[model samples]
Target: MKETVKTKRRSFKHLVPPVDLTGRIERSTRMDRTIHAVAKAVRRRLGPGRLRDLLHGVPTGKPLHPPLVTVSLGCWVATAVLDLTHADPRAARAVLTTGIATALPAAAAGITDWSSLHREQQRVGFVHAVANLTAVGLYAGSLALRLAGDDRRGRLLSFAALGAAGLGGQLGGHLAYRQAAGANHAESVAHLVPLGWHDLCELKDLPDGRPVARRLGYIDLFVLRVGEGVTVLADGCSHLAGPLHQGRLVSEDGSACVVCPWHGSTFRLSDGTVAHGPATAPQPSFETRIRRDGVLQVRPAPL
Candidate 1:
């Protein structure tokens, strides 16, 4: 007697990503570490003050990367339009020159932002930097050739540069929108929660020296009680939205502070001031009170 055997094939949809994709991620991760180390060394050599301010956009409400990228990429777009139409070489050259000038500041701002990101985000950012650098090289070559009166070669190089820039722009969008790398993590908490006092918990439920998590609607809050007074802040860290309740509580300059578990950015619990950074913005602090029912309450601080 003979026995029959049967096997069912797996669906293509159930298959995992190819091994090469995993290899690419690993390689990018290694490069991310190397880039970060090099950047740190360069920063140490430069020291601090104006250079740091320029990189972090200390004078601006947000990270400088977005505006710098917009200006440089906008110039490139104008040049690309001119190239496609075979417009005047002088006009194209002027646009390309402006783009090149803005590119340096954009790269500096991007590097500054990238250095503070987590490992996974850093992996994406590293590939982004490489793509941008390649584009820069192509554009620089194109500019040199154009200046030398070799319009044919210069135009071809500009097309290649545009392709590289498109790839880098895609990665940059993923970093900003998907990864939330440079977002103001606590901004939403300001609007979503009700304006008046919302009861958090009973005074007895809170621990004396520890932070407790409380949720109201879409907002998560970190509540800390010290004797009769309570401090309430948005649970998300402004840097990367790290859970503040999980962070260690410490005193900085005689004020109670919470250190973000992700990036070590510290915030004063009382006023939401940035005591330390990587975080350019402050945490969202709340006004707290003991309600008539003896329940703890919190409201968004006055603007």
Candidate 2:
């Protein structure tokens, strides 16, 4: 007797294209090439280690991009409102000028976040930067025209610039909220971890005053051996997941703290407390204990 067999075909339902924006968000290859060259030159001038730290915001345990972008957005909105309503010209000019002035610093913060991002994120960020820069130029021209007795022309130009800035802001929002670029991608790891200590590795494997990387199922932990005991923390830096295990262990008032190699965000080895700003969220700490067989074990702390 012949046996009947059935085969199932796989579907491509999950391969849907991303929602397209009203306007093209694609970056020019030539522009990207130029930016890459410039980034490399800047990196060389700053030195790899310093540049990496500057962009990483390790000290704050969070990426500086969001705040900077938010501030820029606020300035743009305020300036636009003032220009439209003919509200205090001095204040409008001040806000617009401040926004333009702050762009460089904000760009610095963004670059720090960008350094640790994936290739796709980097590409999106570069495009976002170009768009904002163009908007800034337009706004500057508008300001000049306004001061030169061309109020109507100035207002029109300002409105146009505001429109461009808004588009740039939307793209940035997409990069952050939608794409999760410059975000702590490993945040869900805490939820996945079990509530009890699990054998990680031998205690001796972790050197004194050094950060060691260990795995707890899907979660990566940065383990530090300070004194008689070991402390375990999320291995990925809260700022940009910059690999805290590569950071330096420093003593702050006789307490052990790990300094992130990326941006210098320091965390107490005992408990994940923000020793500094930038990183608003505390690093998720783990309950650490030694097993009977002299193995170091760790688990998620009680909520």
Candidate 3:
């Protein structure tokens, strides 16, 4: 029998991410002053509320910016197809205008999400915003030129806009996947936690009316004891894994809530659901029971 050798195909997942530009940008503190000023302004302007939560896609349970961006990019690409095929100039202008118009809401959600990110994420996001804004400006000029009966120049400007938009989109992808910005940082807790009740601590040992951190297998849990009632939730903020144990516990809407110290994402203690975002995903909450031996035990709550 003859032995045959076969070559294995290269897997995309096995390939390393192109992070050179992002690493340099993340390390360079050249724009820290400007980044800080803009970040503060955005946070103040887009503070936690119904309107802000809606923009963060808390209601839809997804980031609105990502999906909204597709509409604008799709229209711009359609315009490019029309221009390249030497199709009617009026059709190209119509699609280009639509892309420009839809960019407003997409930008609104993008900036809102950017406001609650880590400093490093914000640095990359600033550059991403600049590239996108440049694209919008170029597209707007393209529209103006078309209206002025300069189809050739309009097409040229639109092509430039596509380049800028593509650059912005690439940076956005890096943020979403590599940096894990806007991702559910605490999503793995349920998977790692074992079924059945795990011993937490004796009820009397818990600090009264204070939030504290406790270990539950691989997950760190945020435990709060107010009189006889106990609330247990995964200790990581669902946004960026900000320490919920280090957060401020306050009453909002007549319910106890913990505000993430890092990005201010708020979760209601009752069921670990987002009362405010930047965190579209809910924290993993647990059900507790006190054993006959005075031990407090908890298990993952039913979905």
Candidate 4:
């Protein structure tokens, strides 16, 4: 250490300020609050469970919004291309009409998507929606102007709309891919779980057929012993991480399922498959074996 030593310097080159979107952010936040209020009111009228099921395609076991949004984007692109290059006014009008018609379904799908998202995700989604709506308005105005003989003004407005839509699309991408909002959070749990089950509790400690809460290091697991076999799953529900241990166990078609206390999401005890929706991701399952000493041990199941 007395000799000359070179220290490796840390670089902050990749660090940058938050995207300079203060004005947009503020407007989006306000809008998000308004949307939140409206959504709450609507949910109250619709009933929470009904609203959740309706909006999230939980019954279908998939996200309904992403595909619908993609279709909207495609229609928007088609409209823009036609407006920019088509010599026939009829063709341009047709394309514009199609785009306008497409937006309604897109909005419906977006609303459904928004209902299942967390508060933070809803905030981001609000901004993304507003940006796309602005772009749609611009495109509509451009079309009107072009039809009224203001070709130059129409082209400018169309281009502006395109830019706004692009920005909105990018933000939506961040919300989905980057934040992993509305994504399956349980898929990675297998990797985090230790290879074998550590001690959870004595067999006598858990009531038969009732959900029992047990801890493994920092993670919480729910255990249900059926017959001689023990079923272990993440205690947190995949939908909103609601405590699964508090939920009731039901026998559905001869298989055991645990229903979430918060949102009623259900997971199968046999394989951790999602038996009901609002939760797209399956719960993490652990393989259970009785040790030679008669202690219960668990290991993460292979994918």
Scored by lDDT, the top model is 3
TM-score attained by model 3: 0.92
Candidate order (lDDT): 3, 1, 4, 2
- lDDT of candidate 2 over 25-104, digit per residue (tens): 44334456666766666555555354455455555656656677677678878988998788978888788778877777
The CA lDDT of each predicted structure is: 0.83, 0.72, 0.91, 0.73
User: For all the candidates, what are their Cα RMSDs to the real structure?
Assistant: 6.7, 8.0, 3.1, 5.7
Better of 2 and 4 by TM-score: 4
Q: Write the per-residue lDDT of candidate 4 for residues 129-234, one digit (tens) a residue.
A: 8888998898789889878988778767877887888888887887778667667766556666767557766666667777788888768888988666788998
lDDT of 4: 0.73
Clashing pairs counted in every model: 0, 9, 0, 1
Each candidate structure's TM-score, on Cα atoms with residue i matched to residue i, is 0.78, 0.68, 0.92, 0.72
| Sequence-dependent TM-score of model 1 | 0.78
- In terms of TM-score, how similar is model 4 to the real structure? 0.72
Query: Candidate 2: where are CA atoms >4 Å away?
Result: 1-32, 47-62, 86-88, 201-214, 222-231, 237-283, 301-303
* Residue-level lDDT for 266 in candidate 1: 79
**lDDT of residue 85 for candidate 1:** 95
